[model samples]
Target: MSADLGWWGVPLAILAGTLRGSAPFLFVSLGECLTEKSGKINLGLEGSLLMGAMSAYAISYLTGSPWTGVIVAGIAGMALGGIHGWLAQQPRVNDVAVGIAMIIFGSGLAFFLGKPFIQPVAPQLPSIAFGSWSSSPQLESALRVSPLFILGVLIAPLMQWFFRSTRWGLLVRAVGDSPDAARAMGISIFKVRLLSIMVGSALAGVGGAFLSLYYPGSWTERISSGQGLMAVALVIFARWNPMQCLYASLLFGGAQAIGPALQSVGVDAYYYLFNASPYILTLLIMIITCSPKRTLTGVPGALGQTQE
Candidate 1:
């Protein structure tokens, strides 16, 4: 039932790829946004992602349930976040340096532990057949959607609302903007930041789980491909706005799909070039969004600074 739509299929393929590709970006960006909102930067999320992927894949292989793997992966990410948070709180410690160290630790740990899982198969996440109404088998198959993608879309608006309407959200913003003011107001800066980092790390882990358990659906050493780092740039580009993160994710997702879309259209030349599109696009986004003349509009105050 494999029918080709000729050159017309490229757009469809890209569209499908976008849906699949955007989920991880959306999740990771959202996680980083949360962490930055609390005035902390976690560069170690790249490691958290790898750890999450390996944990999820391994757990699923053992437990016979992908959801369990997802939950465990989140916990693993939280542990990493907790470690980073604790280390950052130590006297004279540098948050960025600790984060870099954590990244190495996380990656090394995952690599060592994940070795056993590389060859095993895990249960695949279930997808909704959104293309049920379509007669074209290719279109139908292309439209098969993961529930996680839908969840990410739903979470964006909620995050926006949470920041605008909730007391805790205001507290996080206050802490990020001015620690002195937050302390004067009787808010606990340490608690807020610690919790934020842990929650953000958990979200990143869930994103990792989505990568291994759902989309590409496997465990591997190179599974992340720097998606976590790309997310840092994405948060900056989005100006730390949750809603904007959704849009940015889609843009990145489309960029990632370009290579495969070209292949679908029989443009096999320079396949490596097409595959490099995502990284190249990341570079372009960073260059366009960052500037020397003006202060960034939405950067959290005290970001990357050691908290007292």
Candidate 2:
């Protein structure tokens, strides 16, 4: 019932966009989930993400390997996460304050280092063309799925299992739910929390790499576009479950695709307004789904506490 594409095609386009766009959300939220589950919070992941994007792009451009860039991005994120973890171990240091400082430092460092990379071209992550099986060229183009997305999907279940069955997962849960119990078991709180934060930061870095090296496929000052911060809210919305994070990320991705989907169907009025629809939708969903009662059920008990 349309010119370029039929009415049914619009939804399909949105579906494609959702899958493609959800990769960053999935990875970021998973990282946030991991961090929160370990009784620590890192608000500075936004900075880590930005820094990762910058480093990924710069490295890819310099080394001619996007995968290398992704690896470097993970390392960059881990470096920032390690710093946050180490500072949190200091006497009288607040995790939130340290996280904020890391954000400022990482962002400033990234901006300074990323100046020359703004205009340079970098290698992009490759995609698998699932649309090859389709008869439609549009479908084929839309079906070009990134391997990173598939990896994220796989990671969700793995994370869920990790928390449910693995010894490390039990330790993280113990540290999160009851620091005293973890200590009683002779577990080092500093080591567990620090390791969790580092892993979370590394995941976030890979998420950032997905942004610059895959989706928009470029380096810039604002490549992250606050995806890391949004992921914090998403983690809250998911109640800290990794599997829930996968679905929630898809919802967010679909919300983001609404604007572009409308434009593709010749409904481009107030494009900026449409662009902001994803945030609005995500907020509404969070408000609708979040229960005031039992609000803290899934929250880690020891989160944000300064242990003496």
Candidate 3:
């Protein structure tokens, strides 16, 4: 029994790590879930997320209020999403290419704006007290999970329920599966997609704010750490389901924490590979879940059409 209990500890430790590590991925996954469900892909999520991180820190540092930064970050994200949506509505613009371009622009923008913020310690987010539950340092450390993690978990179920049970969700589904048919049914497909993109961007902005206010409050080029790109792939892995994204993001998080664990144990050889784990997993999940046939059949029919 003692041995069995000791073995059980490993999973519990991983679970804690998963909760801590997956919080960011969860935000990105949730945002992507909203975007994809509306039948449009917002690849610029990387740029939006980074810009949010930079913007949040800068705003909070100046104002001394973390909440203010969070709000501004959301607005910035909405702006990015709106721009992407607006451009996508144009006849000649390619969404994929536009996303890549935004990534470059966002990167430059963050660096340019974050120059002054690199040294200052920005405002910190308030945390839930997991510390009260235990005395052992290990246990206490494990308990220090982010509130955002909890929120992300809660969001998954709520989003799932909303989409399956609400009128607005039905409209979103209508837009994704068949815009023409939805139009025939009196739903405005363009309006649904536009709304979804804005919502998705706002969520993605929140995800970026999570980085600045929570985990690592310092601004750097690598803060977002390619999380945006991988999250784009996570949408496919989650199969258009927000609830599934919660689980999938946690799985990716667990995988990500492995290398750090190794480094702690004095094994440094696998660090780079561990750093790459999330993207690798994201890519694999995409390949496994994406079916060319099914995408054509199930995806929003008006995906590439001009929204005029």
Off by over 4 Å in 2: 1-3, 269-273
Best by lDDT: 1
| Residues 1-308, model 2: lDDT tens digits | 12367566678867887878888889888988999999888888898888888999999999999899999999999999999989986878898898889889988999999999999899898999988987777788778989989999999999999999999999999999999999999999889988999989988888888999998788888777888888877898888999999998998887787787888778879989888977777778777776777565689998888866
lDDT, candidate 1, 1-308, per-residue tens: 76769887877877788788888888888988999999889888888888999999999999999999989999999999999888887777888898899889999999999999999899978999999999998788779889988998998999899888999999999989898999999998889999999988888888889999988889889998888888877898899999999998988887787888788788999999988887787678778877898888888897877854
Superposed model 3: Cα runs more than 4 Å off: 1-13, 268-276, 279-308
Worst 10 residues of 3 by lDDT: 1-10
| lDDT, residue 241, candidate 3 | 81
The CA lDDT at 272 in model 1 is 98
Candidate 1 is scored at a TM of 0.94
How accurate locally, in lDDT, is each candidate? Answer: 0.88, 0.87, 0.77
What would the C-alpha RMSD of candidate 2 be, to one decimal place? 2.1
For model 1, what is the error of residue 253's alpha carbon versus the real structure, in angstroms, after optimal superposition?
Answer: 1.6
